[model samples]
Target: MTATVHTLQANRAPSLEPMMALTTSGMNAVNAVILDRMQSKVALIPELAGHLIAGGGKRMRPMLTLASAALFDYPGTRHHKLAAAVEFIHTATLLHDDVVDGSGLRRGRRTANIIWGNPSSVLVGDFLFSRAFELMVEDGSLKVLKILSSASAIIAEGEVDQLTAQRRIDTDEDHYLQIIAAKTAALFAAACRIAPVVAEAGEEAEDALDTYGRNLGIAFQLVDDAIDYSSDSATMGKGVGDDFRDGKMTLPVILAYARGTDGDRDFWRSAISGDRVADEDLARAIDLVRSTGALADTLERARIYARRAVDSLGSFPAGKAKSAMIEAAEFAVARAY
Candidate 1:
């Protein structure tokens, strides 16, 4: 009769510094590709794209690509362009997401959509997507192209599905899982999957990395959802109550709703329906999630997925790359702590 403990001590928490250090040189190359390709005759495209691209994102997707490639000890630079393409795709999605979410802040800075207006943000997002495709094509790998292109389409479909589910209290945990798998995990899978393709590491390695990325992505989003209720805007890099105000059916809200009293449910209904967005409602919402153990449980769920992600790398040789990747997963789940 063993209990699963998911929380990390503050002094003993995992960090991304190892992964960042491992991919430093490769990421420099990818960043160059990103900057050069983002240039366009239309000034507005570069301006809007640069705003979010240069924003303080962790660039985790592209970093995964580079680190996965390093797992194979890949000597060539073929992954640099592909990793840049992954970042372009990710950045484009963020731009469009800010517009769709009507968000005001990201990475503790003003979102491009808020600063440049929605139309400009959306069109610039399209431009970045086009640039991503161009990079993918220039790489001349049909397999890589297929993987990333399909991921892009799946991400779009997921976004639409999430839009349909938005503001709907009936959205369950399984349904929410499906939406995040597509919207978030799809790209993550592709990013790590492309690494094996470029390294000629065969399908088995590709599958393993895909599993790692997909599970890590799910865990990452779970912590983010939990953080929305447990953390502040400065800590989360966006408005703290943005999800509640947007009526996002994240796991915390879902779990809390499922476990809540009738009165609590009524309060959630009102809060999620856009009727109660004041500070007190947010405080009450936080209280409900905490009292119901929804936040703690969400972090626990993230820990499970993070462990799966780490276990998926068992086939790979143990080295710095493997250690860094494992630490990265730990870091993902530990962020909420």
Candidate 2:
């Protein structure tokens, strides 16, 4: 049977706004720390960093860090520093991602690489990476240091794995999951996991939050992959079809290729593997993916993970933080709308 296609809908439920509101005070402190730490006498470091930081994308990762800490009633301000570190790592990855993807747009603005040049962007990314470590070291918690450092290594490994899998239509669903798990979910897991560490909330709470973050991260990336095909460049904050143009074999593409007819498979291989794809080719690829039900199935898979993310919070007592975190999972999938 052909793949099942379902109409997509926007999530009208309040998404991240509530979570942001819940953590507003803590996030303000985190933002202050971020602004203070991002400075430099070299001028370009702040210039480049601020270019992306001020571009208006939601600081979801750092928000997760703060909210997770609040979930456990963390007493110290250490999480503020950790939240800043998380943001730095996330922002650094974005800069490098823009360069790697040869992307020209992010958050509806010119990419840092496009305005500042690739070398500058890459070097500044390295600067941010080093700064993240500096912040970690300043916190002076060995456990915290270990958690974030390991996540950084995993994120780098995930990027390399994705590089290896690129343009290879033979890449499967399992491999796609592995790549995103490391690249995207690792940070989310680390950010949440660190909250419990700082609060001395014990291993049980830490594990639950880690599970929550990992599942939410997977769901988040799934929707992001789907949006790349379905949304406009302006709405998505990045080039539409950038993944398709780069031959990145995300879950939707993998599912479509597997479910497609022989001719459909051939078209996917040619469209993705070629040196250059015309606009018409991307249009046809989107149509093929939709008809094969890849988008709907991929999103359905995301919803499952989102539910798992929400379920992970069941162990926590009923509270605003727990509720917000649950909505955060829903937001991850709902963002596709």
Candidate 3:
């Protein structure tokens, strides 16, 4: 388990750091408001839903929503509602994911499923999903509903594909990209895109934000896959090799398999494909990924996406908000550390 990202420091933000601190300060305020909104409803489903709220997550979805709104000169209360909406949608997914994965630990703590059980988690997830729909209807906009609904559908499709594709071990870059775009990038795209519509940025501006979010989300997933094979369990908050153990093939593993030697390929096929693995298999998998230089190459690909995210900011004017977005993209990649 290594935490070093070769490209993590490539983007140096002179003022972006301070602006990020400000963004985070604002994030805390928004978190409180959103948490309050959640509390009003969690009492009915506390065992499953409350644990998810108290659980640790980066809250990146709402950060994108608020930051995008701020960038478009939105100085109104609507952004708060939208931010909370993004959170509700994201939290709902986490609840469902834990149930689907049968995960016992999240953020180094017991998952809602482990504490309360799967049915509770699933029902509470349904509750949050319905709550998000209710909030979206309050906005009275069809476009918002369309984007979020599409994202939710894509997320579900991604989960289904992952279930079917489990441990195929032949999962290629295309399949890996598709699954992640559907699973992770869909929410990120929605979060960044809805702001332009809420702020009434022109169609062109809205499209740019959508592209930015999609690319940034892809980059984030790439680093996450790298971390699965590289980072220690302590920092990752879940088992280091859970991806393989759970039969989910990601970019790093796919690339490593392609470039590995005969012995490397055999070890992975037998040990990883079979489910139960020794520590030596984990070590060998790490070595195989490193031996093929896949980690460095994949990290470079992630860097390109981060650059694309910054480049998309060309559609926005100069402001602290835009700077924070650039910083957020960089920070996403740096999170590998």
**lDDT per residue (tens digit) for residues 1-337 in model 1:** 1222333346767989989999999999999999999999999888888888888889999999999999999999999999999999999999999999988889888999888899998898898899899998988999999999999999999999999999899999999999999999999999999999999999999999999999999999999888899756666788688899999999999999999999999999988878998999999999999999999999999999999998888878777788889889999987787
Query: How many residue pairs collide in each prediction?
Result: 0, 0, 0
Candidate 2 minimal-lDDT segment of 10 residues: 1-10
Q: Which RMSD does model 2 reach against the true structure?
A: 5.2
Candidate 1 residue pairs in backbone clash = none
Q: CA lDDT of 313 in candidate 2?
A: 81
Model 1 misplacement above 4 A: 1-11
Looking at model 1, residue 316 earns an lDDT score of: 81
lDDT of 2 at 42: 90
lDDT at residue 13 of model 3 (Cα atoms): 36
TM-score-better candidate, 2 vs 3: 2
Predicted structure with the largest TM-score when compared to the true one: 1
Provide the lowest-lDDT 10-residue window in model 3: 1-10
Best by lDDT: 1
